[model samples]
Target: MIYLDDLLAATEGRRVGPSAPARFPAFCYNSRRLRPGELFVAVKTEGGDGHDYVADAVQGGAGGVLCQSPPTNPTVPCVVVPDTQLALFNWAAYALRKYDPQVVGVTGSTGKTDACQAIAAVLSTRHTVFRNPPGLS
Candidate 1:
C-alpha cells in the first residue's frame, strides 16, 4: 500500500479534488485493468493520453489519480505533479526506499540490466536484494 503523504512527498505533488484516502492499494496505468483503490496514472504516451480515460477509470473504481492535471469537476482525489511519468518513477523509488532504506543504482549506456542481475546474484548470497531490470514484467 502507498500512503498519500509519502506519495506527495515523493512526487512533489499536491492534492486536488475531494479528500483522498490515507493509502492506495496499488497503481495502474491502464484504466481497463485498474482495480478499486488503485491509483491511476495519467501518462501522455505516444499511443494515447491517459488523461482522456480518467472518467472511465473512476467509474471502474479507482481510488485516486497521479496526474499532471486534475479532471474537471473531479469525483476522486488527485495528486497533481509537473510530470505524471516522472511522478510515477519517483513513487517507485520512494517505495523501494521505504522497504530497504539502502539502495544501489547501476547506470551506464550499455549492459545495465546485466549488471543489475550480476549484482543481485552476488548480494543475494548474504542479503535479500530486489533488482528490477528494464523490460521486466
Candidate 2:
C-alpha cells in the first residue's frame, strides 16, 4: 500500500479536495476496472481525457486521483500534477526505489526482445530476474 504523503512526494503533486485517504492498495488508469482503495490516474490520451472519468472512478470507490487539472468541487482527494503521464512514471520509479534493486533498462528500435532474453538469462544465474515487457496484459 502507498500512503498519501508518500504519493505526493513521489509525484511532486499537491492535494486538492478533501483530505487524502490514509493509503491505497493499487494504482489504476481506467475507472471501469478500478477497485476500492485504488488510486486513479487521470491521463489525457488520444482517445479520451481520463479527467472525464474521475467521477466514475470515485463512484466506483477510488481512494484518490492523480491528475493534471483539479476537478471542481471534488469529492475525493486529488493530486494536481503538471503532467499525469510523467507523474505515473515518477510513481513507478519511486515505488521501485523501495526494493533497492539494480535497474537495467534495455531500449532500442529493434532487437529488444532478443536483448531482454539474453540479459534475463545472464541475470538469472546470479539473481532472481523477472522480466515484464510492454504489451503484456
Candidate 3:
C-alpha cells in the first residue's frame, strides 16, 4: 500500500524548509497524530509554519516528513511541497487507493463514540474489527 512515487509527485513545486535526509514513511499521519514510519504533513498556520514540528514528529517515530520546507533533523527524511494541506489531501487520496479498505468516516456533535462502538459491535460479528482508542472520544 506504499505509494512513494505518488507521494513524490504530490510534492512537486513544494517549498523546502530546513530538514534532514530522505526517509520512507512506515505509515501515514496527520499533523496532530504521528506513528512510527509515518509521513507527517505540516500545514501552514496563520501564526507560524507547520514545518516547525518536523523535528518533534521525527522523534515520535515518523519515518518521513512532508512540509513546505525540509526538516531540521539530519536523520529525518522530508519532502518539500508548495502547499502542505493540499499535499495531505493528495496523500490521503493516494492512501485510499492503495489500502482500499472499507472506510467508515464518522462525525457528530454528540454520541459519536457510542455510534462507533455500535457499528464495531455489529461488524465484529462478521469480521475482525479494530476500533480507535477509547481516549479518542
Tell me, by lDDT, which candidate is best: 1
Clashing pairs in 1: none
**What lDDT tens digits, residue by residue, belong to model 2 across residues 1-137?**
66787778889999999886868887788899899988898989899999999999999999999899988888888999999989877877886886577778887788778888888899999896656443321
Q: Per-residue alpha-carbon lDDT of model 1 for 1-137, expressed as tens digits? A: 77888999899899998876778887788899888998888999889999999999999999999888889888888999999989978988888787664688777788887778887899989985555534342
lDDT leaderboard ranking: 1, 2, 3
lDDT of 3 by residue, 1-137 (tens): 33455677654634243333244534443445776776676777887766777777877887666667675534755677778778766766766676676878678788888888888889989986545544454
Instruction: Please report, in order, the local distance difference test score of every candidate based on alpha carbons.
Output: 0.84, 0.83, 0.64
* Model 3 clash number: 14
Per-prediction TM-score: 0.72, 0.71, 0.58
Q: How many clashing pairs per prediction, in order?
A: 0, 0, 14
Quality of model 3 by C-alpha lDDT? 0.64
Question: Candidate 2 overall Cα lDDT vs. reference?
Answer: 0.83
Instruction: List ranges where model 1 is wrong by over 4 Å.
Output: 101-136
Off by over 4 Å in 3: 10-33, 97-99, 117-137
